[model samples]
Target: MIGRLNHVAIAVPDLDAACAQYASALGATVGAPQDEPDHGVTVVFIDLPNTKIEFLYPLGDDSPIKGFLEKNPSGGIHHICYEVDDIVAAREKLLAEGARVLGNGEPKIGAHGKPVLFLHPKDFNGCLIELEQV
Candidate 1:
């Protein structure tokens, strides 16, 4: 149902500041910030050898990340993404297993330009799970 870990998303209060910290301190390669209007976020990805780390912040008043940051001022890991061969099939299996899918239970194109779906955090041991079709 799940494959390799794709990337870990971190919600931050300041997107540029967070990217600067990673670029300066860790000397990591940080990609350009891309605004996702549909998702209501401005994000930047830090590329790594094995996986990427996404740093994102709210782009609008009703952004989900905004609420997350309100609850956690310092920001934190928002979700962990895992690769799936077939997102629709994986979603069906998960639903059959009593797992709750977030959003409209439909796969939306994610930051990586792949179909992705988010699962309820409570259903996955308090950790939000993102399934990205690989």
Candidate 2:
């Protein structure tokens, strides 16, 4: 049902600072910031050999990341994304298994320009799971 790890997302209060820290600390190529208005986050991806690390900042006052930041203050991991061959089929299988899907249970276009769906954190042992069709 899940393929390779896609990316790990970290919610940050300051996107620039996070990106700079990653760039200097990891010495990795950090991509430009991309504003995803639909998701209400401004993100930047730090490329790694095996996977990517996404730094997300709230885009608006109502952004979900804003709430996450409020809770964690310093910010922390928000979600982990996994690649799926077919998101619809994956969603069906997950639903049949009684897993709770977040939002409308429909796939939305994600920052990577792929269909993505988020699963409830409690269902995955307190870790938010994002399924991205690759």
Model 1 lDDT tens row, 1-134: 68899899999988878988999999999999999988889989899999999998899887889888989999999999999999999999999999999989989998768899999999999999999998
Worst 10 residues of 1 by lDDT: 55-64
**TM-score of structure candidate 1:** 0.94
RMSD of each: 1.1, 1.0
The model with the greatest TM-score is 2
The 10-residue segment with the lowest total lDDT in model 2: 19-28
Q: Whole-model Cα lDDT per candidate? A: 0.92, 0.92
Q: In candidate 2, list every pair of residues with a backbone clash.
A: none
Per-prediction tally of clashes: 0, 0
